[model samples]
Target chain A: MAAAARVFSEKGFGGASLEDVANEVGMLKGSLYNYIKSKEDLLFAVVRPDADELLMKARRLSGTDLPASEKLRQIARVHVEIIDRKLPYVSVYVQEIAGRGISQEWTDMDREYMSLIEKAFMEGVEAGIFADDLDVRVATRCFIGSLNWMTRWYEPGDPVRARAVADQLADVFLAGALARSRN
Target chain B: MAAAARVFSEKGFGGASLEDVANEVGMLKGSLYNYIKSKEDLLFAVVRPDADELLMKARRLSGTDLPASEKLRQIARVHVEIIDRKLPYVSVYVQEIAGRGISQEWTDMDREYMSLIEKAFMEGVEAGIFADDLDVRVATRCFIGSLNWMTRWYEPGDPVRARAVADQLADVFLAGALARSRN
Candidate 1:
């Protein structure tokens, strides 16, 4: 899966060949097919773990008895941690999900993951932990819009800086940068 | 350039070929080559106009003697308008810019465009229009983050809906959705 992710990241989903993955893994093309049905299936296998990891983390955090604000912070922290631990897989997931004419299964998985985040926002708003008037859908999108782009700039070894960025982003979404005293 | 944008948007920057653009424009590849040097050059041409349009619009609005609030509103409006007017080109730009091994010229152009946006945020902060504690760089990134993602979901010929979404985003960024009276 790691070999497949590197090839996919370099050549893109449409451009990558199964033979390249096989070469990287030091296996013949026929032997590679023994383990994976097809290139698309291989792509899915490479990305599925990262997606599962993200979903699992979100579920575990939501199961906690914390306030909505703390839940959001946990969500942010978990996301950063996942990206740090599985950088290449997460990178492939981010890049390939946006491609046109994606499979229905892929689209379904994308929406399912997004719905987890959306539910978190809705829960927060209802709990009065986040802004009451917040458009939960748009806020959810904004959260995704901010966090997904981090894959483009984040360096895995720099966990401290990544945490600082996550905290700043959480603050921006929660209280905003506006001076509270002025209000 | 418009034809090239369409081709690039439909079949990503790396996926698109000069022949495809030529076919779309009712010209031979040889004829297309007379106007542009390569696929990369054609992409640069398609993207450069929008950059110029955005920077020019920003400058015109900021150069106005209006108050900072109105200036910020105008900048947001211009950004939304660009998405409406040039959705395909903007989509191509966002998708292509994130991948591996882009040219230095392209990188410099991207930085230049980003700096233009950062300048507006800086001006707002210096004028005491935005919050003092607002990190101008992060604020600028947030704005771009919000605006750039619009291309993903915005439907063409739905200007009214687009405008509403844009206004809501502007409100979220400026006043936040925290029920301001309570705040």
Candidate 2:
């Protein structure tokens, strides 16, 4: 699957072929069929587990006992870490190539992930950590935008560098979302 | 050029042809040849002036006498309005299609724009309006990322809504960048 993911990432979903995946795996095309039915299935294989893991980790972050600011910081850190750890796979997932039509799963996962971030903002609001009238939806959207846009520019992934970026993002976003009195 | 921009936006630069541009203008391809030698020329025509105008406006904003927060607010407002006003043209410029290979102009324009935003951050730092030790480059990149990411989700352009979004973004971003004492 890592082989397939790399192939898809390097060649793009539309441009990648079953042979390319097989080549990456050092296996012949005919033998590779035993593991996957088709390229769409390969794409599903590539993206689904990662999304599931990301969603799971987010749930854990939301349910943690930490303060809202700390949680947001950790969330940003983990988010960037995973993005770097998974590297090009996240790149392909965000791109959502023509085969994005193959299923609605990606769209559903995206919405769920977004709402989880909103949940963090809401919790902060309830705790008096963020502004009472904070536009949680807009704030979360912009927050996510700032992080996700990194995918466009952050090629040649380095886990340490990504961690630093994560810290910087969290610091700024927390400032942006803080209760007026807290600042 | 409006017709050509629309055609390029709709068909995509690589997928689009001279015939498509000519047809978009309701003319024969042969007649279109009198104006543009090639598709690359048309792309240059469409993008250069919009970019030049955007840069000119950014320069004016950098020279403003407004406080940092208000300046940032108006910058965000004007940024969103232009993206909305220009709609798919900004979209195309960001995408940097195959024809993007034709020149380094887009890359340079993008760098210049980024630096302009950084200048805004520096001015705030110098005014002691933002944290003296703030990571200006990171802050500016994140700020621009927040706005540019809007283009991905903000498909239906409405000036009023774009303005509202601008205000929200600016408000939050200023909150993020404000000095500790100010808060």
Candidate 3:
């Protein structure tokens, strides 16, 4: 799975071959087939687990009794933690899932993942925790966009710095930079 | 140039061959040599011009006596407009410019382009036009990430929608979700 994630993240979906994954694992291509069904299966194996894990965490956090602002903060923290923990898999998810119609099941799973985030934002807006005029759709995209790009540059060993960055992002999103006292 | 952009964007720089570009142009691979010196030359020709044009626009906009906020808005608008206008080339730029040691010139050009946006953000903060706590580095990445991802989803014929979306993104970045009155 690690080999598959690394190769897929590096070469993209259409560009990577099963043999490349096999070579990385020091296994014969035929031996790889004994364990994984196909290239698509390998791609699914690499990304789907992380997606499911994220959805689970998101669901657990959503069910919390926290206010919307804290919920949003928790959501951001969970997302950053997941990316930091599973950097290569998340990298594969970001790079491959967009264009390649690997499977309808994966696509639906990916949408459900996004819907989870969107729901959190919507909940915040409805509860008057977020600004009234906030466009949920655009804000959701921006949140996802910022999180998605982290895999490209985030270094895994620097969890403290990563967490700090994530907090800053949540801060920027939840509260505008204007001096509230002045207003 | 358009052919080269399409081929390179679709196949990536390492994955694409000169023959692919030649085939896209409905010409023999050998005949392509009449127009360009090499594959690297073709890539530079397609991408550098777009970078040059963007910098030229930035230079012209910088000369204007606009306030920092308006200047930043204009910079964002220029980014979206350029991506909308020259999508294939921009797509190529997004996909291929990273991880290429031989393309140091293109990499330098990209850094220069990104620095332009970063400078605008920093200037806004300095002028007290933007929020004081803005982490200029992260904010700049968020801006570029949002703009660059547009190539993955943007439909060129829908200029009205594209511009509207760009405006929404600028609003989200500059003012954030929190209302101005609250700020």
Candidate with top TM-score is: 3
Please write out the lDDT profile of model 3 over residues B41-125, one tens digit for every residue: 8888898877788777877777677875566677767778888889989877766563233466766766776677778777777
lDDT against true structure, model 1: 0.73
lDDT of 1 by residue, B135-166 (tens): 66665566677777667666766677667777
Provide candidate 1's TM-score on chain A. 0.88
Residue-by-residue lDDT tens digits, candidate 1, A85-176 = 77778777776673233888777766765677777777877776667777777766766676766666667877786687776666666655
- Candidate no. 1 TM-score: 0.86
Ranking by DockQ: 3, 1, 2
Full-model lDDT, candidate 3: 0.75
Q: List where candidate 2 sits over 4 angstroms from the true fold.
A: A1-44, A97-103, A155-157, A177-183, B1-46, B97-103, B177-183
Worst 10 residues of 3 chain A by lDDT: A174-183
Clashes of 2: 0
lDDT (Cα, 0-100) at A137 in candidate 3: 75
Please report the candidate that would top DockQ against the real structure.
Answer: 3
Residue B83 deviation, candidate 3, in Å?
Answer: 2.5
Stretches of candidate 3 exceeding 4 Å from the true structure: A63-65, A99-102, A177-183, B11-17, B36-41, B59-65, B98-102, B180-183
Interface RMSD list for the candidates: 2.9, 5.1, 2.9
Worst 10 residues of 1 chain B by lDDT: B174-183
